[model samples]
Target: MSTSPPAGPTPEEMRDMLRAMTLIRRFEERASEEYMAGRIGGFLHLAIGEEAAIVGTVSALRPDDPLTSTYREHGQALARGTDPRAIMAELLGRATGICGGRGGSMHLMDRERSFYGGYGIVGGSVPLALGLAWASHYRGDDRVSVTMFGEGAANQGVVSECFNMAGLWDLPIVFLILNNQYGMGTPVERAAAVEDFYPRATAYDIESWKVDGMDVLAVRAAISEAARLAREERRPACVELLAYRYKGHSMSDPDTVRDAAEKERWKARDPLVTFERVLLGEGIMDASAIAQMQAEVDQVVDDATEFAKGSPEVPVDQLADQVYAQPWNDDPRGSALVNP
Candidate 1:
């Protein structure tokens, strides 16, 4: 989908978007470096090319709105106002991390920012987000819940189930499908019956739209409209943002499955570059301002890395903590201790 040209964002907003995108880019780049250096453990999914989808959708959300995202969620959490240092620390599994070193890269959480979590399982958070929206509605709150997942997850039966429940309950929720073309090594065409995901939401009688994910402004406008509809009219909405991931599905995949020319084609439409061109062309920002924004983002990422490096790891003996609620000793008869 092509983006419609509006009057263009104010210089300040444009600059903010630039800073956010650059921060995400630099953060992911540093994360890759850290992962390779053995500083970060576990799966690391970098949203190198989908910055617009994260930054733009997050910019449209209310401060009190809750967010549930897939594993590729560093950008979303940062855009939702999670502290960069804390997020970096979480990636490093530090005791001072967001989840206190328990939930690493795939499980960052910050309830204070209304960021629910970064779920590892595909489509696992869809129902959770719906339940959050239901809670908000039951409390007579206007806050909405935004659930983000990749196109690969669109086929999950859980997603459709959540959509049905949200529609039936008239919940204030936005299901954002970040269609980045490929689901790991398999492309969307190979998995989804219909590549146009927005239309799939119509089966549940929800309002839906598709936007150009490479254009931050377009994504922001579409999501803003969707959020407004959900809040004011008590309607559920879905949006499919057409985007592409420059890196492999995870750090492990070399992205060899797709053609080299296709990768180059998507790279040419990199969200950061596309947005910068629009801003500069519209006279909202110039090269100097962009350079400054890049520098600021670089410093933020560098500081986050240093913070992660210095943060302490969880104690080895406490590794099993929080796996399940602490086992209760329900022996009311005062039975003697037994180590069977």
Candidate 2:
């Protein structure tokens, strides 16, 4: 006799997942407003449509598990429990920002939260995650390292190198490929010879899984299993999450590359909208509950924006402080002076 399928998330867990997704949506929307209003500078990438993939993957990880992310990582950081005010402050270049206003949109880090960072370079987080996993393996700890990148970064040579080493040493790590269809205007089909990314890890003897990233529960389940394989068995795994982004690659793009029909088709299955139906159908939440949650999320985003606006700017004297990991003083034998 065959065993039954695993159970789904409980009512409380479902409610939390929906709330988290709503928060990310509202935060990104407000962030776009800030950027347009000239408050947030530099390039901004919004994950308007991939909330399920982010929240699902992050929710599956342990508190101590280290995770790295690509540049489009506001959702990842938020899902990892970074305060919304701090994230907004970082975007606004405030001293209270997560990175002390040094690293902005593409480079948020919270070491205390085990969110390694959001790297600007494509595939940059892979090697860092590998190093984190290696450290855990060396220390005989079970903490897993999760590195998330897009389909575009999958082609990076460094990523393949990490895959080889991870398989060779059986490092406890999970490589999550957020295949959102387009890598800055170029479709994955046009860029990648193999559109199905999970199979790439098989060459290294690493386990792999593909999941419906539009469904939060499905993403959570798939990532949960992948993380378990890494943590319990001390092996490497890969998960390819097929999701979509509703906005342009960056705020600068006109988003004219993709066909309008394709976008509408995807929007019909919007994670938030579809999940709301699921919640209602399962009797986990009602229309009033969803409206209430949306209102609360909006208020949270508004408060975060105000907090960021009110936070102090980084002092000019502290500009060169964190340039080098270790402090260095001016000396005849050394280089020029760098004040703190």
Candidate whose TM-score is highest: 2
Candidate 1 lDDT score relative to the true structure: 0.88
lDDT of 1 by residue, 1-340 (tens): 2243334456787778878998999999999999999988899999999999999998888878999999999998889778899999999999888888889899988899999989989999998999999999999999999999999888899999988998898999999999998889998888988889998888899989898999999898888888887888889999999999999989888778999999899898888988889889988888998898788888888998899899889987676577534442335764224412
Instruction: Report lDDT (Cα) of residue 152, candidate 1.
Output: 85
lDDT of 2 by residue, 1-340 (tens): 0122435678998898899999999999999999999999899999999999998888788878999998899998898889999999999989999999989999999999999999999999999999999999999999999999999999999999999999999999999999998999999999999899999998999998788999998888888888888988788999999999999999999999999999999999999999999999999999998999899989999999999999999887675568544454545566544545
Model 2 scores worst on lDDT over the 10 consecutive residues at: 1-10
Each prediction's TM-score against the native?
Answer: 0.93, 0.94
lDDT of each: 0.88, 0.91
| Count of backbone collisions within predicted model 1 | 0
**lDDT for model 2, on a 0 to 1 scale?**
0.91
